[model samples]
Each structure stands twice: as structure tokens, then as C-alpha cells.
Target: MKKALALVIAVLMVLSIVACASPASSNTASNSDSGTPANNAPAAATSSDSENITLHFTWWGGDARNAATYEAINAYMAKHPNITIIGEPVSWDSYYEKMLTQLSGGTAADIIQADYKWASDIVLQGMPFLNMKDGPIDYSAWAEMPAEYAGNKDYVMGLATGINVKALWYNKEFFEKFNLTPSDDWSWKTILEAGEAVNKADPNSHLLWANSDNLNAFMQSYILQLTGKHMIDTENYKITCSVEELTEYFNYVKALFDTGTLPPIEDLVVYEGLAYASQVPEWLNGQWGMCMTYASNTLQVLNDSTFEIGTMLYPVMEGATDTGISMMPTQLLCVNKASPYQKEALDFVEWFLKDEEAITISGLQRGIPANTEAAKLLEQNGVTNAIINESIAVAAKHAGSAEGPFDTNAELNAAALDYIYQVAYGVLTPEKAASQTIDAMNAILATLK
Candidate 1:
């Protein structure tokens, strides 16, 4: 368990070093620039699928995802008798570290899955990836091309696999037992009240099972909604929020900790690095009624729960200018520019997104499909999850400003995350935490540009 946090911290340290290195455009050495080995490498010009070759694809998810992905991979391989595609599935906690190691060593999977923001960081680090538009993917299938790549016309970082929004998942049984409703009108205050009620009735349980990552994201939403601006204005390379606003955000966070809506700091510290509800046992054992996770993760987050689960919009703030919830891509799928088998890899990627069989098998495992036709097919087959679809509606109905690239800078995020942790633990007051966080973020932002 300790290794989890340590490994996570190590990745952040590595990123900080990467960020401080020579400007990416001038960096000589890059993980993506590593040359492919002759023996197993695919011929650069070969576009035919007739050749017998093995390819590897990597992604991170829970048991449901693994099963669906494995099934899909098998289906693909079975269709192309000569091509063997290996599925490299990793747990969420260990994914980035492993992905980074592979990328640094020039051993990254032919098809690389990355968070959209991380994909930007990868490019900024001088890592090369294929301009997916030059490949076999059908652009017309997409209803809305992820605008993330709009400004960087030369690069389509990855073919987006799905679209998701940040939201909370509630256990129906627990909510019913406590006479609570996870309704569309629910607000931050409503959740706190519900949590207090749950704890009063059963001290052994808490209102939610949220870790550092989840809580940090919640803080981001609050800041965005309250100020109508993000903490960092990446385009200008500046810290955008005032300390007064941050103090308000922290005070709300403190209220959550104080009301027992979330467990004590000690209880969640060990699970700090965990990114999903399915990762912790508290959600599974019914010790918590709700957990915040990305909409894409609904199926996986509820994998083993015996209780029926429901989805709700991320709680809103009254009279807010923005919804504070933005629809984000699920994962960016890019072909390794260094891959010997770029042609074949692109073929598989195209098939995964455009093929009905692939889309149906994958289902809502990755949330709502980005491909218009794929979404239609899933609807035709009734393979879509109702709650997951509802989550998408909620996100659209209350969409806010899109998060910018620098808005989620790895180093700056780590700094603020540390402060949030301190505030939760009670040793740091909200004012001090907000002041220190602003100073720390400004110092990091100053290094930008």
C-alpha cells in the first residue's frame, strides 16, 4: 500500500524533472524518439495485414474493462489469423509509472492509451506520436472531433475512445436506507446533510469513499464554478484564482471533513493514490453511500457491488455562473510514431472505433462512445447503460468551460494536492493552506513559458 503512494510520488517527481528539462522543442532525447529494434520491428512502409506479426496494446481499468477489452482483442485477432494482438492491462494505481517506463525505454505499446492532458505533456516532453488523421481512421464517424487537438493542427494526439464527465456514483440501497435522494437538484450542501444523516444513523459508515484524487477534483470544480475561471490560466501561463477564493474552497472542504460526509483524513491517506471507487473496499462493503469518479468508469467502479448503483450530476452550487463540469474525452488512443508496425496498428485502431462488433463488445466500459455511428449501434443493441447515459445528459445540461492544457500541469497539481491533503488533516488552516498553495503554484507557473 505504501508503495502505491511512493510510486505515485515518484512519477510526479519524474514529471517535475521532465518539465524543468530543456524546452521540449529542443530536447534531444525522448522516449518516443527511441529507435525500434530490428528483429521484432514492423517494416515502416508495410501497410498490408497479410504479414504475420505481433502487436501490443496497453490500457488501465478494472475487471469489467479487462474482460471486455480481452474479449474484443480476441475477436480482432481471430478475424486476422496472421496478426496477433496482445492486451497489456494494468491497474489504475500502477498504470502511468509502467507506461512511462515503457515509453522511456522505447518499448511502449504500439497502441498507447493516454489521458488527453497527459498526451499533451507527452508531446511537450518531445515524445513523438503519429498524427492520427494521416492514418486509416474515419473522421466522419465522429460527431464532434475532440477540440483538444484543434489548436495543434499538426497533431491529433490520439483518437478519443469515449467522452466522460466528472460525477458522483451513489449506492441506491444506502441512499434509500437513509431516505436520501441523489437528484439532479442536489447541491454540495445537500450532500453534506445526507452524509451527516448517514453517519448519525450508522457511525460505522460514511457518506462517501473519496480519496485525495477525488477530493482534489471536487475542489477544482468548486473553484471553477465559484470564480468562473480556473486556478491556472495556461494560455497566459499564470495563476488565476485569488487567495480569498481559495480560502472559500478550502472552507467548504473543511466542512465536508467536519460533517463526516467523508471519512477522517487518517482513513483516506493510505488510499491517496487510488483513482476509482472500485479500488477501495469501503464502497464495496457498503461503508460509504457514494463516491466521485469519472462517468467513463461507472461500469468498472461498480464491478462487484451487490447493491444497485445510480449516477447523479456532480453537485452544483447555487446561482453559479458555470456548471463546473466539463465533458472530457475518456482516453486518447495514439499510435507510437516509433512503432515498426504503424500501419497495422492504425488498422486495429480504426477497426476498434469503427467496427460495430468492437464497439458492441466494449459497450459502455469506456462510457459513451465518441463515434456517432458507434453510439447508434450501441443504442440499437441496447448495450448502453442507462445511468451512464443519464450522466452524459447531466454533464451536457450543466457543461462549463473546458479545462486547458496547463490548467492541469502535473507539477502544479502536485503542489496544490499536497496543500489540500494538509487542510484535510487539520494541521493546516484553510487560510494558510490557500496562501501557501497560491505561492507554491505561482512559483511553479513562473517557470512556465
Candidate 2:
């Protein structure tokens, strides 16, 4: 009987040891199922569809833009758990230089924020940004002008984020205090007369704040108005207008200076290299009543003012061939052809441009939304500013055909500015300045061909 009882005890002890060993094996299987660890679990888990892709999106803007973009990116990532986006925001001054270097070295971000003018230059030079025509991005909701930019095959650029046109920004209080209303006609003669009247009323104030950059833009519009030709004929690889035509354009600018409708060259010089209206003394003090600026920049200008601000039609040259208002894409988004995540990059762009939530977050900081539905959405939500709405409407009604890619040619613009400064300083007759400008521009254009 003792021998039999000892045998039972030994059997029970073995059973207990077996049960303990079972849990160790089961725990390993449980860890594997829960994606915790099984000693050799893959370094990173990935969805079958996404493979855990990551993309880099780069752009240049101020603090507001950076913050808004980051928020939008975060929202996108929340909805797309398998994807990650890295944001690279830089200042406008160093943006192009750094991008160019990265592009050449094959290390550029997968998604690029391209200047409209730079799109053609980069794509046509054999850089391979993905062609959206082959992609899933729905651009049917964009306005005609911005749509045109996206549809071009040689450029094959991404959707425009904003539509920008040069607008006349004015201080409403200054106009009212002088009993001045902007001319309904928006003709050069009428605008100058209005400016002269305002300057006469308040010796401390000037009719307009003119800087070389803005003045150059005005000159381009005036030339377009007169000649019905783009300043540079990219197709022909030459300047479209003659020296005589440019002289006439410069003479008008000179008249603006001589009559005190514009500030002296010396006064304007201090504001060079500054990008915002808020930074200019004349704008801050309300001494300058009006200026030429992009629709995209109107908010910043308005924010710094103590009085209500208004927008006017871009001035027209009397009996001119064009309205002198060019509506162009503010900037574009492009996908690198070499990027491993091309489809994902395009997906983000589609969401960024057309997504209602993203548009609300973006507002008009980048100018009017290029997506028609997005713009309407802002209006429906009562978030669209009245000034921005008016500017968009005015630009749409009066805008001319978009400028050619070469219109914003860096070398040509630099040469034009130099010649303009010479005319403003009385160092050269308008004729001489015009002649020199044409020659220099044609020389540069020839090399480009």
C-alpha cells in the first residue's frame, strides 16, 4: 500500500511540471499574435498595401504658413496611419538655391513646392517631375487659368495651390480723409490724377509707394497693355517690344516719379530687399495711399494697417491692347519622378488642394484657393475674408491671359530693374534706358535658346 501511494505522488508532481512548461510556449505564441515580440520580430511592422511609406514635402513661407501646413500634415497622417510626412519649410531667400542643389544631387524632397515660373525651367531641362495627367489627382474643380498650368505636358507640373494677380491695395481711411475715391476707369491717366490730388491735400502723404520691384511689375503690365505681347517671347526666344515702346513705358513711369505721385527713388531705396508691406515705413504711417501688390500678400498688408483697407482694379493704359491684369498660378506642387513614393506624394497634394478641411486651415494665406469648390467651401463656412473675395472676383473679371513661363525670368527681371533704377535716378533718358534694356534682354534670351 505505501509503494502504490508514493507512485501516485510522483505522477502528480510530473503533471505539475508539464503544466508550467505549457504556459511558456503559449506565451510566445501570444506575443507573436499581438505584434509585441517573438525574439525575431521584424524591425518594423508594415501594412500590406502601404509598406509603411514616408515622404518629404518642402516649401518656403513665413511662420503662419509653416504652422498651417504642419497642422494639415498632421491631420493627413491621422487618417493615414501607415504613412509619414516630413515637412521642410524654409525662407524664400534661400529656398531656390537649396532646392536646386538637392535636385541636382538627387536628394530633393519627394514632393516640391515649385514656383510657377520655375516649373518650366526645371521640367524642360530634363528634370523628371511626375506628370499629373497620368495620375489620379482630380483637377476638374480648378479655375481655368490654374488648370491650364497643370494641363501642360512639357511642364507636367502639379496643381496650383493659389491663383495670384497684381492688385491695387489702398488705405481706405487715407482715401476718405482726402475725399478721394479710386478712379472707376482705372486708367493710368485717371489714377495719376487721383494720386496727384491726394498728395496735394496732405503734404505728409504720398499718392503711392513705389519700389523698384513693384515698379518693374507695373512696367511689364504697361508694356503688355501697349504691345499685346509678353515682355519676353519665349517661343521666339526674344524680347517682343522695341526700344521705342519700352521708352514710352519708362517715360510714363518717369512722369509718375517727377509729379510726386510716387515717392522719390531715394526714399524707395530704403525698402529694398523687404518682402512685406508691414515693414515699410510709408505703409505703417499711412503716408502712402496705394501700392501694387499680389493678391496673396493683401492680408499681411491689411493686418498692419490701423484703418480699413481696399483693393482697386489694376490700372489700364488708355486705348491699350490688353487689360494689363495677368492671372497666374501663385505656386505649384510637383512629385519627383525618382521618388519611391510618387503615388503617395500625389495623394497628399490632392488632399492638400481639394480637401475642405485643409482649405479651411490654409485660408487665403497663400492667396485665393485654386480649387473652385474649396473657395466656395470657405464662403459657405463664412471664413473667406471680404477683401480676399473682392480681389478674387475683380481679378477674375479683368485678368488677361496668363504670362508665359519666361515672363518671370530671373536674369531679364534683374536687367529690367537696373535700367528702371537708372531712369528713376535721372541718370539715363527713358529712351537710353529702354534701348539698353532691350539689348541686354535679347542677349540673355539668345543664350537661353
> What lDDT is reached at residue 183 by model 1?
83
lDDT of 1 by residue, 1-449 (tens): 99999999999999999898743321123324545433223336543657686778889877788899999999999998988888888766667778777666676788877777675566576545676654456667675644653215556767888877878888899888888866888888888888888888988889888876666677777887888787678677777888899999889888888888888888878887777776678878888889888888777666667789898888888877887677777887877776767778888888888898899898887778888788889898888787778888888888877766665567877898899888988889999999999899888878866
Stretches of candidate 2 off by over 4 Å are 1-50, 146-153
- Candidate 2 lDDT over 225-332, as tens digits, reads 889887878788888899899999889878888777887788888886677667788888888888877777766777767778888888887787677576677788
For model 2 the TM-score comes to 0.84
**Among these predicted structures, which one has the highest lDDT?**
1
Model 1 ranges with Cα > 4 A deviation: 1-44, 47-50, 133-136, 149-154
Work out the TM-score per prediction: 0.85, 0.84
- Name the TM-score of candidate 1: 0.85
- How does each model score on lDDT? 0.77, 0.75
- Model 1: per-residue Cα lDDT at residue 368: 84
